[model samples]
Target: MLAPGIRVVRGPNWIWQNQDDGEGHVGTLCEIGRSGSTHSPEKTVVVNWDSGHRTNYRVGYQKQYDLIVVDNAQIGVKHPNIICDGCSKPGIAGIRFHCADCSNYDLCATCYGNDIHDLEHSFVRYQTANSVGVRVPPRQGALKIQLKGIFVGARVVRGPDWEWNNQDGGPNKTGRVMEIRGWDNESCR
Candidate 1:
């Protein structure tokens, strides 16, 4: 019974197929969240992915995903300390890609380039500072998409209803957008 908030790596034999539902298969480290029983106490787990998407699955399928603790959990929060295996840099910031199959080999943005890593290899990219969950491999275009309008790390004026941590700068406050999931459909209106 993997509890919520615990990160897990997908197993080799793991199978995920949801292309028809628009949320394609997920093959990255994901946090176990949102669980409950429906009919006969059959539990389910909602996987919170780094790509700003959530997927649900039966609870007993924990064996399909192996849970592992990260060594540089503070990399993104305190400081970008994870040395880039590709470049040997001291501080690798922004989105980082880690290969779970390759002993968690990590590559910084500069080294990653246009997802030049082994195409046959599977990777998971995540933000160092926040528990933004895990994302699939070959995230080259993700950089372009992120660089679009209102990318993460951009400053914004907090509205009166801003919720998370009101102590920073409450109503009419200003703060940096920690992460960007997707476009706001109503931002134009």
Candidate 2:
């Protein structure tokens, strides 16, 4: 699936021709339609154009693509020095989850999502490939808190707290958390 923040341009399959189409324009992907959603039965790639126009283009409708990827570096952070300990993939793509408790231990996004690391240890998330990592203080005691819930680089949804009108790509949509602020013990933003 094409991720948000990816740069894209009009593809050759874009059949629509308009003077306001802004040819040679580049846009950032903002949202993608869920495959099974009622609102968007077809795969839709929403883009925010640099020309101040926001619109969604078709991906697989009629087996054609209206947009093509120009750059995907924003989707995954590249780490030249890090190799995933779980999968042994070099230059871990996407978010790099480094074990705070283990020395020189790192896991790629896939391994981390699959729960490949020791759950007892907390991890620091690197959102960008070239991001400088910082150490997270070890949790008190040996409570063994499972690595779950909201965290930086975590995919999130509005859930039951949703009250606005499709603010986050509508129902069943998910977005990545770039940062957290003023977090409390209750985990309420």
Candidate 3:
């Protein structure tokens, strides 16, 4: 149903439609149609992040369609000894990536201040599944997070919140609090 190298924009939170009711659609920026946002004077959403145009929904609401950046994970905590995307030191598992021109290099929190980020990019990490969280069963009140490592080098691009975020914006805009993986409601003996 898809091809490689095709950048896609999807969300369970919102969708685009011919007639808005909060229903979104999937297509390149060239495919979306016109709505109020398509013609709004004060709105300036990026065409790459979100097509600067009109988006319909499931409800009978219509407005300038704006994209929100949120965490990637549904639930989970952070890992320690986190590696820096810049020098790739203090390497650890589960550290998040940082970037300024999100469309550019996949930099990390440590490297956010480095020359890679064109602007004064902010360094933030994600702890949600929507960003880069994983599931862990309750065993000994302990969990060891692992980075989605690659096979090229001892260092890997830390990672980033897989959100449709602005290259250089504020904190997470939206997402939900999901449950911990395999966390029993029962108390420990």
Q: What TM-score fits each model?
A: 0.31, 0.40, 0.20
Q: Rank the candidates by TM-score, best first.
A: 2, 1, 3
Off by over 4 Å in 3: 1-13, 17-38, 44-189
Which residue runs of candidate 1 sit more than 4 Å off their true CA positions?
A: 1-79, 138-189
lDDT of 2 by residue, 1-189 (tens): 377766677776887564214556667788887878665455787776654467678888778888865444455436777789999988775567889888889987667656686766888877666567655443334333233334478786675436888988888798998874322322111
- Write the residue-wise lDDT of candidate 3 on 93-143 in tens digits: 223554433432333333432344444343344432135432222223333
Q: List the global CA lDDT of all models.
A: 0.46, 0.66, 0.31
lDDT of 1: 0.46
Query: Number of the top candidate by lDDT?
Result: 2
Answer with 2 or 3, whichever has the higher TM-score.
Answer: 2
Residue 118, candidate 2: alpha-carbon lDDT? 76
- Relative to the true structure, candidate 2 reaches a TM of 0.40
